[model samples]
Target: MSQLYASLFYQNEVTEIFSDRALVSYMIEAEVALAKAQAQVGVIPESAAIAISNIASTALDQLDFDALAVATGLAGNIAIPFVKQLTAIVKQNDEDAARYVHWGATSQDILDTACILQCRAAMTHVEALIHQCYRTALAQAEQYRSQVMIGRTWLQQGLPITLGHKLARWASAFRRDLARIDAMKARVFTAQLGGAVGSLASLQAQGTAVVQAFAAQLQLSVPSCTWHGERDRIVEVASVLAIVTGSLGKMARDWSLMMQTEIAEVFEPAAKGRGGSSTMPHKRNPVAAASVLAAANRVPVLMSSLYQSMVQEHERSLGGWHAEWLALPEIFQLCAGALERTLEVLQGMQVNAENMQRNLECTQGLIMAEAVMMALAPHLGRLQAHHVVEAACKTAVEKGVHLKEVMTELDQVKAYFSAVQISEIFKPESYLGNIQDQIDAVLQEAKGEAK
Candidate 1:
């Protein structure tokens, strides 16, 4: 029933997501603010609040959204026609009271409320997906915590690390992003109060109370002043969302690379009808992961425009606000979809522990050079030990012999450690110092936050 994809990508389904129903909620809050402002100043009868309340309670389906859309263009936003319709409906019942509907407010008041309301709704979806992805990442980390694999520094094998360690890093990054979202709630949920320009000069003495009451009615926090020209909050929120999605994208890209046939370290599980290439019958692709990566890459670029839109002229600039109106919703929806798909991909992931171990040994004990060097440090000086290990590693590569074997053949290496000790240096498990502890710390923090 929800046309999320259609509305976001195709720009169809006008009354869905950021639609009339959503804007009507904003209008209701704006009308309440107006009535409260008027009542506080004794400008309008308190009875008007009750009348406005009743009129505003009408459903979105009762409004003439079609004519409003056709008349104003989607760019007109639903707030203008919304106030027009609300005033018309109220005036038909009581002509005298209709004048009090929008008392001291301008279209920005209603539009800003509607934008935040849509953001709240969209964020709810995004938060759920983020949590889902966090859970999947935690599970994957726990599942493969001890599965040893070759670690690459610059696309070449550098050391040995457990698959779980790699996954736990991903989990940790997402967890940090989740904490950021929680911390941003106060900043992001604040109500906008710019009237015509960036000041509340029209409301005179009752301005602050009206703003607070309006925010209370809408379940949002009131800002100290109007934000007509202060778009930093919007930019901040957009940047965080982009950062969160970007983390997911990084994970997807890594997974895509690891899923390469030459690597085969991990694979996203295939569904019954998923990942089929058009021409290749035997092809199983990382399509979902790739999709997540692509979406993540696009979110930041879209959000950057929001940041750029912050440099508007004093009071108001259609250039800045209108740019936001075009960009923010799409960024939120795309990021939400990317996060959702990332969670789905991770939840059904296939981790190959055997392949991880196999790859860890693929370098013929060269992956254990650091461990060997560290072991020899107590006997040999640090530089001397490193040179010896480096030479052994080079000989192993050039002569096609194992590093441990080369080390055993050397009298210097044998003097430092026995053959058995040399063999122990190459065991991947010995090199996993603090990795499990790090994972535990991350998981503990996540669990504590969840509680």
Candidate 2:
């Protein structure tokens, strides 16, 4: 079922990078680790370990997973049928050794190991996609670093800013999220082995050794205790996924807004047949951005359920773990889809620098009020300067005159600055302070850390 959903919604390049086949291989690897742990604890004979290792090393096709699934009810699941099949394979020549395949471990030990492996694989794709998106954003920022546009606050034009500066902010957010995911690797890949009741009493003397050996075999960190009941790790993964998707969603929303016909400062690529609304033949809608926003919005709701599921009872809460099983993969798949589409949208974006500049002058220099006010602050008291600027702006709006014309009408405004100074204040380049430098810093940091 997980594989089907992933194939349907996540059959993109990123999904291919972290395929379910790899996840199944990881599950098989965990089963082999369990067999080895049993052997070290004297629960299984040395011969059984050798045989299990040999069998696990072979292709998954070597085992009839379909038959095993029916036999042990492990279809569309990982751990149970894995153990059952390994036990069956081990007992083929020595029936007595079948009892040792699972030994003191519960299903979660194997399941959690498999999940970590899957996460590790998925993280590889996540990291790559994040870097790609950040690089694209940096490039876009550099291209429009000085491209002036109106900055809106509360849906109103509040100031003048470069489009590059805005894009740099989005890139910086992605860079931070990538760092966070890298930092979480150690915690997320830790082993899970709390046994049936969050205790290793069943293994007694060799519990620690078995856990260490199991972690070594699977190439994961050995946790201090079984985390069957403590689900913070899963919650953390979900939260990170949510945050990354949300950032991309914000970018998508920005694109959607900018591509509005009345504000066509930016647009997605004009695909031959894409984004066509049946009723509007002339529409080149921002469908990629819209899809990304929808994916991002839906992911948070799934992640919210994951957060709520953390309050589980006892050492092994089927309710909580089950909730995670349902929510985690969906989050992974949804996030993958969003990232894929976001990358596509950004890489092929149609940046209208000409329109951006034209729109910068759309309000006839009213966007420069702050600049005008700041220039007048030294000559007038700050409050008095603000009042003078505000009154001029109001008069300009009512009279259909430019703010500069209204400024020319006032003796106080003339005494504060000349026409050249006013023109410099309205220049878009002056307002984009350190925006490119910030992008360079973020890109450098991301590259250094990724390496």
Q: Write the per-residue lDDT of candidate 1 for residues 227-344, one digit (tens) a residue.
A: 8888888887788888887887888888888898878878878888677788998878987776677778678788878988988888887678888877887677667767767877
- TM-score for each of the candidates: 0.91, 0.90
Q: What residue runs in model 2 are displaced by over 4 Å at the alpha carbon?
A: 1-24, 40-43, 62-78, 93-97, 433-437, 443-451
Name the lDDT of candidate 1.
0.78
Output the lDDT of residue 106, model 1.
84
| Pairs of colliding residues, candidate 1 | none
Model 2, residue 442: C-alpha shift (Å)? 3.3
The C-alpha stretches of model 1 lying farther than 4 A from their native spots are 1-16, 19-21, 36-43, 74-78
* Residue 232 accuracy (lDDT) in model 1: 83
TM-score of 2: 0.90
lDDT on C-alpha atoms for all candidate structures:
0.78, 0.77
* Candidate 2 per-residue lDDT over residues 77-181, each given as its tens digit: 456676666677667755765666677888788777788877777878878888888888878877877777878888777777778778888888878888899
